[model samples]
Target: MLTAKEIDEQLSILQETGRKISECFSSFGSRMDFKPSPEKWSARQVLHHLTDSEIVLAYRLRTLLSENQPKLKAFNQNNWSATLAPEQEELPLMKSCFEANRNLTIRLLKKIPASLWEKKGVHEEAGEMRTYDLVVRNTSHCLRHLEQLQKLTEASQAVKL
Candidate 1:
């Protein structure tokens, strides 16, 4: 179980990471396409995926905090990624969506009672996870994808010179 302060700290880190992502994308001229070696998600695709996830997780957090619901529906991330087209290099839109969703999620987290942190949700593949765990996991997920984006950007830059 995580305290509210800890959750806020995690949210802050996520927001800072989002800012960094926005800065990095601003420096790019051409839109990157999803590559097979990188597991088929381009820089933009990854951002889109993150945006979709943030939306879902934000909803789940709201439900957990407000509805007293014990189990929320599971999501198929891979399927979702496959379904979303990668044409949009709209980094600004992606950043805005991420920021909005994250701010809402943080606000919801702050309002959630500490006693309800242990509420459980059964994911289809991942099995049962606590609401607090879900929030922490989402933060870590964003960090992992951000690192992937950084690595991809570095690799692309190296190829240019």
Candidate 2:
């Protein structure tokens, strides 16, 4: 369960992380390939993954805030990452999607009633999680990816010199 204040804080952190991610993408000198690593996603793929996750999670937040505890569907992130076409390295597209979704998430969090924060949803694997917890987790997910992107950028820069 989260108070409105806590939700607001999480929203702030999410928005800040989104901004940092955009900055990171903008800093890249050349378009990175989709096949940088066999096991790991390339920078472009990572951005695409984040965009997809943001869109899906934003919808989930809306549903959780608007309706009774709904049975949320789970997704296979690895499969999605592998299947999504990485034909273009569109940083602007990724940044726009992230910004729009994050703004919507912040607005939704602000609108959700404090009492409803404790509403429970059944995740396929994680079992039951409170709506607030889900939102918090989603924000944390963005931060984690942002960190990964930063590390990738640093590693690439190191290889240049």
Full-model lDDT for every candidate: 0.72, 0.74
The collision pairs in model 2 are none
Candidate 1 structure lDDT:
0.72
* Number of the predicted model whose lDDT against the real structure is largest: 2
lDDT per residue for candidate 1 within 1-161, as digits (tens), equals 66668766776876787666666555555636635365666777777788888888888876766665457777777887777664544677877887788777767766767776777766656677777778778878878988888877876676653
Instruction: Say what the RMSD of model 2 is.
Output: 2.2
lDDT of 2 by residue, 19-125 (tens): 78667667765735433457877778778888888888877766766677677788888888767775464678777887888777777767767877788877767
Candidate 1 accuracy as TM-score = 0.80
The TM-score values for the models, in the order shown, are 0.80, 0.87
Tell me the lDDT of model 1 at 144.
Answer: 93
Candidate 2 segments whose C-alpha is farther than 4 A from its true place: 34-36
